[model samples]
Target: MTDLARVRAAAERLQGHVRRTPLLSSPFLDEIAGRRVLVKAECLQHTGSFKFRGAWAALTALDQGIGSRGVLAYSSGNHAQGVALAARMLGLPAVVVMPADAPRLKIDNTRALGAEVVLYDRATEDRDAIGAALAEARGLTLVPPFDHPEVIAGQGSTGLEIAEQAAERGVTAADVIVCCGGGGFASGIALALEGSGLRVRTAEPAGFDDMARSLASGQVERNAALSGSICDAIVTPQPGKLTLPILQRLAGPGLVVTDDEALRAVALAFQRLKVVAEPGGAVALAAVLFRPAEIKGDTVICTLSGGNVDAEVFQRALQRQAVND
Candidate 1:
């Protein structure tokens, strides 16, 4: 149900709230990818991720009476912090259900942002059920991570920026690669670029590539494993009902990248672009850097979706760059 109009409306709502992340490029990165590469440093966005854009849009779009009662959401990490901080800013109480295995930094950050955190087992438990129960018990409106129309519209605002920024740089046509989980971000961008020359493509971690598989098979598919990948920020079980349909109609074939590739990308982004990228946030950059065969055209733009990484994980990623050097 999300379209360009709704995305533009969301951008209007987000005018003063969210940061318009910059589009960055480095000659070293360009040489590595064998093409001109532009990285959208959304890792610098509020809460250290692009999730803030959607969180703000979704929470603000809610009915005043309903939102004041509180809001609830479930996410591995990025979305949790986004919703938590947005709720705090709006003077609304928030309860976030996060997987027990989510990065410690994200869990602690959510709590520090003044939201109550609930931990759940991602494999043996259903986060949706837990969130729903909590929401019903507390009279809280649920702000979904990616499935809702408002959230998609909020995320679509990223695409609007990409299109305009690319134009300023004289990039009339290129591939826009997005790090996709439930397809909300990618689908939103696709909708925003509906008639633009920039084509949207999705990138995912290898084992948790439900979006890639779904795009390949032309049907929604689920990932077999849930808690193994380091890209927890983007490890969703399946594409959302609303997101999948939009992607199926608008997006190009999805690309899949490995954990090592993701980590390497995190390191490289830090070294080359001086931007810190968490594993999930680096997948799109990984696709552009390591999976060059799957990409096309003379130019590519990708998002560094988040920077909410644990110290140890970030150290590991950085060491890879040191080892290579």
Candidate 2:
């Protein structure tokens, strides 16, 4: 499990670097779920995702000399933009290796932040291997998306913000839900909640339910089947080695929702809450809507982790919502 002290240190380290996003109460969501619901809008964060928190924390935690050497990373989208923006802020060059199928909007945003983009086929090429080789060849520091300790520590900052915000609002023991991909964000948030009164849970897509399975089996589980979902950002086949144990220890329970449900949540966020939530970001809300009994407490906080959906995907999600209605 991630140390609470380390998580707090990361929060302190990133004090001025990231936004302390708003925690807004949603009456509609509360009525639907039969509980008080607050949305932590990290979707409004820098680069339109919570990944910036971890990226900034990891990059800033490094030695000043390392920053001078530049940084390299492999991401499907969000983390790529996070690292790119963070590196640019620190005057460091960054190379992000992304899947060819990643959303064009994310790619354009990363490039706009002055980072080099290297595209690879997810089927035929191993992105991590390619990134590692490039890092070794260029003497660039490699920033693993969810596996690195610093990255997790950085992500914990979001949890810290949520905790403080909740406390300020007099919410003492709410259930905090976050969407999980490789479990970095969930683990980090749970670490931040350690010793606090709140409980933490992870929400994931049904197609990529590795964390949910791993929690149940008491061992790490890897899914070889690669399926597409609207929540592409949280489609990791396995939990990161560093984040899995932390999540298993801290997170309350794992919840899985279908792609249709995820898209519906996204639409609900946009229509009812007037918030732009990417499909991955909306999974936690979907969990609360679809499986309310599993989550205890009158108060619940769901982190809207990103808002980087492409126009095409967003339109499709809207269409799905119309059909469902």
Write the residue-wise lDDT of candidate 1 on 60-161 in tens digits.
999999999999987757787889989999999999888899777768878999999999997899988898899889999988889999999999999999
Q: Write down the worst ten-residue block by lDDT for model 2.
A: 223-232
Number of the predicted model whose lDDT against the real structure is largest? 1
How far in Å is the alpha carbon of 209 misplaced in model 1?
1.4
List TM-scores for all candidates, in order. 0.95, 0.95
Cα lDDT over the full model 2: 0.87
What's the distance in Å from true for residue 217, model 2? 1.3
Model 2 TM-score relative to the real fold: 0.95
Residue 19 in candidate 2, Cα distance off native in Å:
0.8
Q: How many residue pairs clash in model 1?
A: 0
The per-candidate count of clashes, in order, stands at 0, 0
TM-score of 1: 0.95
